[model samples]
Target chain A: MPIIEVRNLSKTFVTKDATVQALKEINFEVEEGDIYGIIGMSGAGKSTLVRCLNYLEVPTQGTVIVEGHDLSKLSGAELRSLRSSIGMIFQGFNLLMQSKVIDNVMFPLLIHKVTKAEAKKKAEQLLDTVGLSDKAQAYPAQLSGGQRQRVAIARALAMDPKILLCDEATSALDPQTTQSILQLLKKINRETGITIVIITHQMSVVREICHNVAIVQSGEIVERGLVEDIFTHPQSRAAKQLVIEGKDPDEFAKEQEAKSKAVPILHESRKIRIVFGTQSSFEPVIANMILTVGVPVNILRASTMDVGGTARGDMILGLPADPASQEKIISYLKERGLAVEEVQ
Target chain B: MTANEINMILTGVWQTVYMTLVSTLFGYVLGLPWGIALTVTAKEGLHPNKVVYRILDIAANIMRSVPFLIMLILVMPLTMLIVGKTYGSTATVVPLVISAAPLIARMVESSLNEVDHGVIEAAQSVGATNFQIVTRVLIGEARVSLVSGATITIGTVLGYSAMAGTIGGGGLGDIAIRYGYYRYQADILWTTVILLVLLVQLFQAIGTLISVRMDKRHI
Candidate 1:
């Protein structure tokens, strides 16, 4: 069974003047030991969706089943115990400014009624795991942003939780720091077998560590699949936008303009964009089709680059101005397992 | 100065210190919990209750609005009932605590409120109960601010204690009134003023020292 299951989850924020629907009937399941990324732009309810998984933000409708326990039905004491088993970290780090790093790490253990000496020993071990054993006596204000996040991670692991929710955990750090933090999270997951749910607006973050991804837009999951699948074959407009924008802003703009112009002349000839995965880029499929089929083809634009260790290419092809020829070309590409989409 | 006058001034100093410290202790004993309730019941608090917050908020405001001197007179009957008399250092403590408690409560509320909501959420994420969040997270985090607030409360109560002298309350203020204002002893009046200033400085210095020692943010 999936370790975490969310069914038809929806959340609406009601105020005096108006009500805002932050999430809408979101449904997804996370298996054990999966690094799942909920990717979205700001205000896309990505944070809210993750918060619901841990019952931080209760869903307005539907049920959240974490390890087969319905979150909404659990009593306060039961919910608290459940929360202790599921750790969470945040972008702000949120370390107690008044406490030393060691004490901050010990906070969760102490809350679980662990003895002071035992909690302290465990905290020191965890701090050593995060490579901050020497800085245990220092306050959070004295540490760098990266170091503060390390302390937060240590604190989150104090309870030996089965799952960890990361809400923009690296958003406040520099690129180098973000890379290091991602590495630490990956290491922790590998060693502990902890399932991680990452909520972030940065597609690069998802590409760096996520095994699977769900693209959320306007309070709904628009597209979801394995990271490689979504990266190479984005089906929804939102997912395509994220993929293209993640690759290159300049190329995305050019592709968008070509696709808009393609729509007006759809009756004559259809402009098609074919996304080539790393393996297929070496094949001379396009050249072969033109040579064998005796159909004239025009290439408007093309670019290929390595993304997440895989070579991918985006090409805009102009076909002969005939419905019969367009149909044949599209089928031919599809038969070869290339992801082809009409530009318009 | 004569030896007799020096003895009187020393006694007055002790009385002033005793009244100030006693009133402040009692004030906080009552106000600290009151303030926590106010903060926790607030609209944006852990367990928001508009009705409880509104009632407490209004009560605190009403108590605070009353001028200290007028309140001292208004609560004379209650003061008599509590202390069995109404015109000495002990009697003055009753009104001083009554007045300072509300002020201290408001100070405590503001101090606890200054604690970051993100920190509170962090505590909650770790399965901290509501009481744990309040005692350990809210109060523990706000300790520095609370200490500073207590310092200010003590200073204000010291000033109120001086005002108590108008109703035969004992302290340096009473001696200043009797020897300087009534008898026109300018030297005695000046000495009392200087002593009050020195007391305030002493309390301030100690308060700052303690607050800084308690703070872990800088070190």
Candidate 2:
């Protein structure tokens, strides 16, 4: 069975002035040892969903079953016990600023009533695993952002949790630091067989480490599948935008608006997007298609990306007005094993 | 100053320090838990309870609203019951604590509130119980702020201990009233004023030093 199963979960936040629906019937499952990612734009309710997975923010409706226990049915003590088994790290790297690094890592073990000596030994080991054993005496404030996150990760792992929840855990760091943290998480998952659920807005994060992904859009799961599939063949508008944009979705939207205004006829013409996997990444398929079809295609946009360590290339081409030429171009691309779909 | 006058001044300093320190200690005994309750019941706090919070809120407000001199006289009977008298430095502690506790409570509440909510959330995510969150996470993280607030509380309590002089509560203020105001001794009055100012400055400097040393966020 999947280690974490979220079945039709919904959460509503009722304030004095207004009731906001933060999550809407979200459903997904993380198998044991899977590096699952939940990706979305800001305010897409991914954070709320991760919190509900651990029962930090109790679901307003439906149930969350983790390791065969329904979180909603558990008592307070039971829930806390379950939470101890589910490790969590946040974007802020919420280490106790007053505590030393070793103490911060030992926090959860101490909370669970482990003896000081044992907790210290375990915290040191975890810090070693994250490659910060030498800096154990330093305070979190004295460390760089990456080092702080490493301390947080060590603290989260102090309980030997089965599942690790990362809520935008690398968002606060620079790109290089984000990469290092992601690598550390990947290493921990590989060595320990710990199931990790990553919640992030950065597509690069999902592409780098996540095995399977769910795209959240406005309190709902718009699409979910293998990371490679979502990146190469995004089914929903949100997924396509996230995959194609790759960085700063809102900025891309604004750029798209500007492009439409600059070239109004570009949208009016028939456009088709073609995706090619690693096998065809080297071949000039688009060029070959134009030469065979004897028609010049207006290349709207083209980019290549590494999806799941394999090079995949995709491009949007404006087809000729003549239906015969369009059909020939589509078939030519299809014959070469390219996934083609008309862009609306 | 004569030997007798200097001796009187020394006693006055001892009385003032004793009343201030003792009152602050007693004040925290009542105020710390009260402040923790206030913070834990606040709207954004760990365990928010409207009823408990409202009661504590109103009580603190009422206690703080009453001026120290009026409260000193108003609680005179209660003071007699606790310390068996309503005069002298020891007796002044009762009213000094009574006045300082609620003010300390307010300060404690605000200091605890200044702790990052994200840290509290992190504690919760790690399965920390509410009590653990308060004592370990909230209290531990807000130590610097709490220490600084205590310094301010001690300073305020010292000032209030002086106000207790109006009711024959012993301290420098009593000497100032009796020797300077009543007997028109300018030299004695100026001496007491200078000592009080120095004591306040000493308290302020110590508090800053402790807070700065305790603060790991900056270093």
How far is A17's C-alpha from truth in model 2 (Å)?
2.1
lDDT of 2 by residue, B86-159 (tens): 99999999888989889989999999998998888888988999999988988889999999999999899889
Q: What is the lDDT of residue B180 in candidate 2?
A: 91
Model 2, total clashes: 0
Poorly placed runs, candidate 1 (over 4 Å)? A247-274, A281-336, A342-344
lDDT of 1 by residue, B1-219 (tens): 678887888888889999999999999999998999999999889899999999889989999999999998999999999999999899999999999999999999999999998899889888999999998899889999999999999999999998998887888898889888898988888888899999999999999999999898775
Provide the clashing-pair count of each candidate structure: 0, 0
Cα lDDT over the full model 2: 0.91
Candidate 1 contains a number of clashing pairs equal to 0
- What alpha-carbon RMSD in Å does predicted model 2 have with respect to the real structure? 1.7
**Residue A155 shift from truth in candidate 2, angstroms:** 1.0
Residue A329's lDDT in candidate 1: 87
Clashing pairs in 2: none
lDDT of 2 by residue, A1-344 (tens): 99999998999999999999999998999999999999988888999999999988989999899999998889999989889999999999888999999999999999999999999999999999999999999999899999999999999999999999999999889999998998899899999999999999999899889999999999999999999877767889998888766775666678888986884653467988888887886888877888889999999888887666677777889888999999999999999988887776
Find the candidate with the highest DockQ and give its number: 2
Model 1 root mean square deviation, Cα atoms: 3.8
The parts of candidate 2 lying over 4 Å away from their true place are: A256-268, A282-284, A298-301
